[model samples]
Target: MDATAPPPLPTRGPAGSPRGGQDDAAQLQLLSVLHYVMAGFTALFSLFPVIYLVLGIAVLSGAMPVDSSTASSPGEVQLMGWVFTGLGTVFFLAMLATAGLVGYAGRCLAREQRHTLCMVAAGVCCMFMPLGTILGVFTLVTLTRTSVRQRFAHGAALPPSTH
Candidate 1:
């Protein structure tokens, strides 16, 4: 043996080549819970743009003017209202759909099924920044592990409610 050779990797915990089923199960459970949490937060944040919708409606109805001093013409106000409404509606729908997909991925992760959907959801989640990014990265890493993949492939994981 070389005198300066690095020590061998420990055969334990996640560092081990084949972490036992229990660790894999625990990790999947944790990831599932985090996915649900991120989904809830995403859904909650999705409501913020609703204020834009409300304001747009008010402007369209003439209750709110685009410019208080009337510098802008009615046509401009109408156009702005439509723009706001359209932007708000699109954002709300997109965010809500992402939240639903993430939640379903969490459910699938818990049950060890629909691995492709979970991977896709995790990839989508990477775009949310901060908390979602962290959760998504961790989920992607966990799901790609050999032992974890085996568990998912074999349908050995049970939902938290069942386990």
Candidate 2:
């Protein structure tokens, strides 16, 4: 090569196509789509039991109109409705509590800003069924394994201790 020759520009792979950039963009798009889908699923999943409970209450109270026009014959339906409402209430409370625990774990995880409150909020939200348990478990796992939580807890990175 001539001493005066210009250096070669970095070429894109395979016919000058920017494969890495394209791959990154594709991954971002895929992840965005997944996030949306998961958000929708979580909203629906968390609210379903509550909805069932409310509906059950309405049904039992004769506020919801069923197929039966006879008011006196709402015995079996009322019983079932009450049962469903009771179960739903129990589950809703449980989900809420679980969410709270997970949130605590989250606060314990952040390094710079130790958002114990945020973690508490997260745990509170987790009280709701699949959301609380699933998210809580994930946050808990992340906090337990990483030095982030430990550092945050101590307000500084911990130095290795010699025995």
Enumerate clash totals for all models, in the order shown: 0, 15
Error of 1 at 72 (Å): 4.5
Report the lDDT tens digits of candidate 2 across residue range 1-163.
9999999998656522456434433433343343234444454555657987998899888788788765456687888798889999987776555434433333233222353543454444455467445554444444343343443454642234464
Question: Over 4 Å off in model 2, which ranges?
Answer: 1-45, 69-73, 111-163
User: What do the candidate models score in CA lDDT, each in turn?
Assistant: 0.85, 0.52
Please give the lDDT score for candidate 2. 0.52
* Model 1 bad stretches (over 4 Å): 1-19, 68-72, 159-163
Instruction: Return the TM-score for each candidate structure.
Output: 0.83, 0.43
lDDT for each residue of candidate 1 in 1-163, tens digit (9 for 90 to 100): 9989999987566533354777777888888998999899999999998999888888899888456576456688888889889898999999999999999999898888988899999999999998888888998998898877877777875635733
TM-score: model 1 vs. ground truth: 0.83
Give the lowest summed-lDDT range of ten residues in model 1: 10-19
